[model samples]
Target: MEGFLYQASIYLAAAVIAVPIAARLGLGSVLGYLMAGILIGPAFGLVGQETADLQHFAEFGVVMMLFLIGLELEPRALWDMRHRLLGLGGMQVALTTLVIMGGVMAMGHQWSVGLAIGLIFALSSTAIVLQTLSEKGLMQTKGGRSAFSVLLTQDIAVIPMLALLPLLAMPGGLSSRVNEATDHSDPGLINTAAAHGDTGMSLVDGLPGWGVTLVTLAAVGAIILTGIYLTRPVFRYIHVARLREMYTALALLIVCGISFVMYLVGLSPALGAFLAGVVLANSEFRHELESDIEPFKGLLLGLFFITVGAGINFGLLFGQPFLILGLALAVIVMKGAVLYVLGLVFQLRGRNLWLFTLSLAQAGEFGFVLISFSRQQNVVPGDMTEILLLIVAMSMMITPLLFILYDFLSRRIKDADEALEPDDVDEQARIIIVGIGRFGQIINRFVRSSGYETVVLDHNLAAIQRMRQFGVKGFFGDPTRPEMLHAAGLKDARVLVAALDDPDAAVRLVTFARRERPDLHIIARARDRTQVFRLYQAGANDIVREMFDSSLRAGRYVVENMGLTEFEASELQRTFYQHDRHSVRELAALWDPDMPTVENQEYIARARELEAELETMLLSQLEDSSDSDSDRKSA
Candidate 1:
């Protein structure tokens, strides 16, 4: 127990210290975990051999992650990706394998050895790629969706890969000897069906090939049936317990139970979890399942990456640094070439092309599993197993850097290859709306309904084009650009409305417009109080907080439900609004852009005083209303 506590503390401490710093530097959490592992394992030796065992346990995170992903996708959506799944995904694995196999054969390796190596390197890191894409908010993009389809296809392909490996086994039958010499616990750190060992339990034990197949099919069928027919009642029963923790426990139980079933049947637990998730996608309790499983998924995935980093054999890596590094690079380049061609063939251009290419160029966590399995099957030589392990780890470690490169390229490209040319400004009006998003659309509709002519401009060409389809004329151009503003009649416009979603862009437009047209009245949208102050400083005549009016209405409803009459609620709400506006104007003068709001003493004191004043005023109004009601009853 003491040892477990110490190990937990060390792992937790390393994560805490390293992850935030990495995030601050924009290196991402995966890289941070890897760095933390390297520090604790190789550099400091604070953690030792147990990292291998912990790796197997930590791999459960991948299962949970797939479950969560499945929850988000309905069967229909999965079907829609069938083309990419079969075409792009199939070609990637096949071409990458053939290419690598040829490379290995050229190096004088046996055909069996080359084929084994090829299969190992064909797959890419799913956990890292998905996590990174999510973090960067690129998951909804064309490239991201394409990558996901390929990943899903690859995951499904793992079953056949597992079946094929044992067939390629050498005559030596070195399974036991290799298991002893190599760390089956580590296996170069990947989530694969190969990791589902025959220990602790087995439903398919000693079964014939046909029996195993039937049991696997039955297990999957049970999962689908359970998700459709059993989950609702099970959740309702758990709901009767009324404890929040019960819901969480049930969620964990569903995941763990499914995983155990998959393991017993000699199938991938992650695949089973994903299947269960998809089955429950339309369930009423879907969100609850996601909320309960998300944190565990993140933590476990982090632990898995840390294990990957810790399991690196630095001794061997340093011994053949050039050869190992060269092999890793070769795998990346070869995979990239295949992806690039596939991307082009599939009509993926510019950012989407690069994103698909660079993101999946690294060898996946499953490479570790395949290599270890190959060693056990005597397909790969013992001396080469260490090299393969190092190669897989190195490639996974470098995956994040590839994503960083994608991000850099994305920034430099900025959709120039695909962006339509800015629409010509052919007309000018007295009033101009700088953005035509949700906030500006309402204003445009109102003004047009009132028979006032106004020019609309926006940076998003798609949005502008969409508006045109609805008979709302809008020009596609950056609102902050001086030429776009002038073309929109900023000089002659009486009122300029800045409703851009980007706060910085709105500020820039307001500042430039105020300078160009001193007499113009500018109304700018502010995301929050800080943005309100920013817009005020930029010389916007009126700054409207985006949610301020809606929030006031919601508060009024709350007070009305709290025993106050409708009239009384209205009076209180009006008083609050007036007081809030006055307080904001006063506070705006004290707000220093250079200092943190919490650290500004004068601002803090004034804010407290304003809060007290508002409370006292509200109480006085309530008392007056009560007295008036009493007098009316007496009369």
Candidate 2:
């Protein structure tokens, strides 16, 4: 017990200390985890019991991570992204695999060995791409979304690639004597879940394949049904229990339990868990669950990556220097070539094409599992497999630096152009949005789509840099300054919205905007009651709250009327500008943070009913008035 406690403590401490320091150095968490893994596993020999055992456990983390990602994507969102995934991602994987396979085969390795290596080399790190994009504040930009679509497809493709390993094995039985190989696991949930495969239909060691498959299918079917039928009630029960700690614990339990159950069925736990997460995203408890699980997820995932690093064999790498280097080079070059062409076909021009290509040209974490499985199945030679694993580790280590290089180059060009594009002294845009957050993003879309030119002003250097990638014209300076506003075309803009997320920033910008363009309609953001009144005092013509009213006014109508869903209704209302100035005046004046959600729900329902009733009543009065006038005229 004491030894178990000690080992667990060491793992936790290593992750806690190493990840932050690595991030601070701009090397990213992938490197941080690698450092942690090395410290815990081989480098320091802290938990140096055995390398392979530790890896088997760490591999679970990857599975869990994938399941979680799957949960985030709904069917519709998945459909929307199918093009990029099937086209861009498939092309990237297929072409890269073929190219690398040819290269490896050309070097006199057997075709099977070459095929195993090529598939391993085809994948790029989704974790690295998403993390870099988010860290750089490109999470919502067009380029970011495009990258995300491709990454999503690649992640989904991991399952099929894993299934393909057995087919690539040679006729000869496993030749090399196993170096203390761990006995095969009892056909647990994973194998059962994958029972659709050829081997999945047969007995491997002892477990009944048919029974396992049936049970696994039943488990998945039950979970899906339960999620659809019982989530709201379960959440209500947790909320009523009212212990914040318990509620948070329950959320974690739900995620972890579903994930574990999925693994037992041979499905990816991360994908299963991620599906649960998205279903509950709209719940009131979402923020709480996110806050609780996010910290643990990060640390565990870091441990997973670190384990990947520790698995790298420096001895093997040194022994076959040319092979390892040649493999790594071929993998990167092939991926880059495939990505560059796909980007061009997808109409990703100028900077985004390079950003997409350069950022994703590496062997992915998934490659480790693929190569290892292939070797176990007698598909790849032991030495060849070891070399591929080393290459993956090195490629992952270099990915962050590659991304940073891209950012550095992108900014240099943007800075040069912005400096050179002199302001039109006499002509300025008729609309301006400050901050460019979600709220500001909406206003910018609305104003620009309505035929009014809009210029965005923001203080965040990262946000400004990201927006430039999407071709958003903006002044990357504080809107609180008179000179900055003038430079941003604010003085000439007929409408200025201080839609910053920060209340103080919004107020400061509001005051500056009012002073500079007194006649302009200055819409400002408010966090609460006090902030709205504060904005009103500061001469804001319109003050929108940061909560639901500000975000949802345009969305509710399409839900009551059409075949539209929440997202579609929201988008349509936004596009049509149906919620006019008068409707906002009626709603915004009375909003308070302390107001209960039930009351708001009742009010919206009542308002819709009242609107119909009043319209009918007005029609009746008009008819009577018209008859009286006609009677008087006849007399």
Candidate 3:
């Protein structure tokens, strides 16, 4: 109990201090977690010997994370994602593997060893890419969606490669001598004292080479099939346990169980755990399992990155500077080439193509896992693995910067390779409204009553279908597109009014119409000051903030109805209306959490006081007017 408390304290402290600081610095949370691990782990040696052992055990966080990731991805969704899985993702892995393998060969290593190392480096960090995109609020954008599809495919790709690794034997292989270590063979696993003892070994001690391979395959199959058949029932029983903490315990238990099976079969634990997660994706306990496992997964994934960082030997890089540089360049260039071509083939265009390709150019987190696994398999030496791991880590560290680079490149080149221009817009209608919501419908009714022809364009089909049921003449499609505009007859239309609820979409339509039909008068409803700016930018002839203008007209009538002197009523109403407009603009600018605030307390207080005084002034005028009218009547 004392040891557990001591070790937990150390990690807990590291997480609390490091993660927030990293987020504040704009370095991102993953970097912060890794920095914490490095500080407490081998680099600083602050955790001591006892803590090192605990930290190693805590590495289960990553295994659990992968399992949860698998659970979120249903097999059907995965199958639906195959075009990208094979086209974009498969291309990246194959091209990177081949290119890096060639570079390794040029550095005097044989293809057998080079091939193994290259394959390991083909992956990119799924966790980081997904989390970062989400954080940046770009996850639903065209570029963000493309990145997600490619990442999902890569995650699924890792499973097949793990199975394929042992099949890739060394050249002129099969030296049949027991108790003999081959120099040509890379350094195999540093078998621990616990493993060497008679505790676990049974048939592995005397099995032939082929028998050993078969044993591994059989063990793997048994676990996968067992996990498939038993996970749902096991989770159901655990649910009846009715304790949330125990459900978490059960989740961890299941991951460890699957991981152990994979390890015993000489397979990747991450892959097995991931498969277990996939099987449980649709289960009733899925959300509970995810919520329970999320913290550990996050911490462990962070520590795993740090472990990768600590494991990078600077000595190897200094000795083989050129080789390290070559390998890094090869991985990026190869992966990048495949991604670029994929963007074209997959119909990803302009900025989206650039974003998709560049976001995934770096080597992934799984590369570290696989390289560590490959080292144990004797397919690659420790030096080679260490060098490759460092390269992968550096690539990860530069991911944010690379994304920025891709953005810059895309902006500069986007105009040249843009999506095809929309066809000509319609111009024949007597009255055209870009949107058909309540506001637009009112104007549409008024115009139609005047015997003017009215045409409505709305993007939402469901809304249009309902409108059609009411005998409304409305076309359903994106009103922003030129073709849709042309089809709606914008060129001959006497007037165009844009009243879309989404400000951005409305602004887009405003801009498109301005360019196509400069002579037609354009009136747009602005949602707020931002929309006001957008309408102005789009060359709107008249921009109306629906609330602002409505409130102003209402304020004028309210002041007059309250029996105020005419001039006083007009002045008070104007001041208050203008103040309200200014307030909205100021509020919009200050909405961000980090946005700057009013610096002087006195000025802020005075501003509030003045606002109150204006309200009193408006009300006092009404009271004076009321008393004078009574006095005049009595006299």
Candidate 4:
């Protein structure tokens, strides 16, 4: 117990120390965890050499992550992403495998060995890619979505890959020795269970091949049915318990129970968790389950990455530094080139293409499983397996650096693109609209109809093209670019509207415009209260939340529906709007983006008090008006 505590302390301390520093240095938390693992594992030897054990445990993080992802994607949403999942993802796996297999065969490897290696190399690190994309706020972007689809396909493909491995095994090639080697080396859950003499517990243990397959299918069906019918009621009962800790325990229990069931049936536990999540996607408890499991997922995921880092055979790397380094680079280049070409064929242009290519160029954690399995099956030689493992590890290590490079290159390209365009401020307009998307379009129409000259700009090429088809002209350039702003004649513009769909970009544009043209009146669109606060900080003269006006209009209709006259509803709405606007400014003043949770709670409480006070005052005024009218009629 003491030794266990010591080990835990070391791992926790390393994460606590390393992650913040990495984040502060602009490196992502995933990279931070990996670096921490490297530092503690091989660099200083703060942790013991039992990385495999830690890895086996930490892989639950990946399972949990997949569950969260499944929860976010409803059946309809999954169906919507089918084209990209099938076309982009399917092509990527097929082409990448073919390319790698061809290369391996040319190097005098057996066909079976080459095929195994190709399939293994085809998959990219889902954990790393998704975590990085989420951290950088790119998961909603075109490239990010494409990458996600591909990752999902690869994960699904693992089932078939597992089934295919036995067929590729060479017959009569020291099968006993292979089994012995596998017992010592295979890190997979099934193999680990077998190593621990838990075969009797496996659902497929005594079954024939067909029976085993049937049972596996049955297990999956059971999970789906339970998710659809039984999960909600179970969670609803747990909710009535009113113990958050119990709810959390129940969430973990569901995930673990499903995982164990999948393990028994010889399937990927992560895949099982994902299916279960899909089942509960529309349930009221989905968000609660996600919130409950998120911390565990994050911590475990960090531990998983750290283990990946620590498990790297640095001794082997140092012994054949150039060979290993060359192999790693070759894999990245080959995968990236294939992805880039695929992106182009799929109509991904400019930044999105590069993002898709760079993000998915690394070998995945599953490569470890495949390599170990291949060695055990005699499909790949022991020496070759070791090399492949090292290469995969190196590739994983390089992924974060690749993201950094992408960011740097993207910024430079954006700047160069802006610089290349000559700033010809020929057509000057009084109102300069930074974004001509849905929000800006309405604003532009209002200004144009009011007889004000307006110039519209948008960064999306496709959007600009579509707008031109509708006879609405919009310049294609990033509004955050100072050069683009100047090209739009910011100097002589009387008013500037920051109406970009991206809140961060909108904030950036507002900050730049406010600094450059202090005399110019700025109208900024915010998506939420957080953005409202940010826009206010950016010197937006008028900040309009995108949904606020529409909600108010809805409220007015509700008042009319509740037996109030249209005029009375309108008047009440006007009063409420004024009060709400005042409240927003006051709240914004109290809101520090980095404020403590306790202080934030206090602020929220104060705001509620103010709202109640305003409601009472409004009712009092209305009563006074009614009483005055009654008195006048009597006179």
Better candidate by TM-score, 1 or 2: 1
Supply candidate 3's per-residue lDDT for 372: 51
Which scores better on lDDT, 2 or 4?
A: 4
**Which residue window of length 10 is worst by lDDT in model 4?**
188-197
TM-scores, in order shown?
0.92, 0.63, 0.61, 0.79
Q: Model 2 segments beyond 4 Å from truth?
A: 39-42, 63-74, 175-220, 237-249, 278-285, 319-326, 416-635
Instruction: Tell me the tens digit of each residue's lDDT in model 2 across 30-140.
Output: 777778877776567676444445555555555444445445556577678778878887877788788888888898988877777878787777666765676677756
Stretches > 4 Å off in candidate 4: 171-175, 182-200, 205-210, 416-434, 446-462, 469-471, 475-635
lDDT of 3 by residue, 182-224 (tens): 1222222112211211225343446787987888778767666
Name the candidate, 2 or 3, with the larger lDDT value: 3
Report the Cα lDDT for residue 424, model 4: 41
Segments of candidate 1 deviating more than 4 angstroms: 174-194, 205-210, 242-244, 415-421
lDDT-sorted candidate list, best first:
1, 4, 3, 2
Clashes of 2: 17
The best candidate by TM-score is 1
Model 4, residue 257: distance off in Å is 2.1
Residue 173, model 3, lDDT? 29
Per-residue lDDT value at 281 in model 2: 48
User: Taking the candidates one at a time, how many backbone clashes does each contain?
Assistant: 1, 17, 15, 0
lDDT of 1 by residue, 424-469 (tens): 7988999999888889999999999999999999988778889999
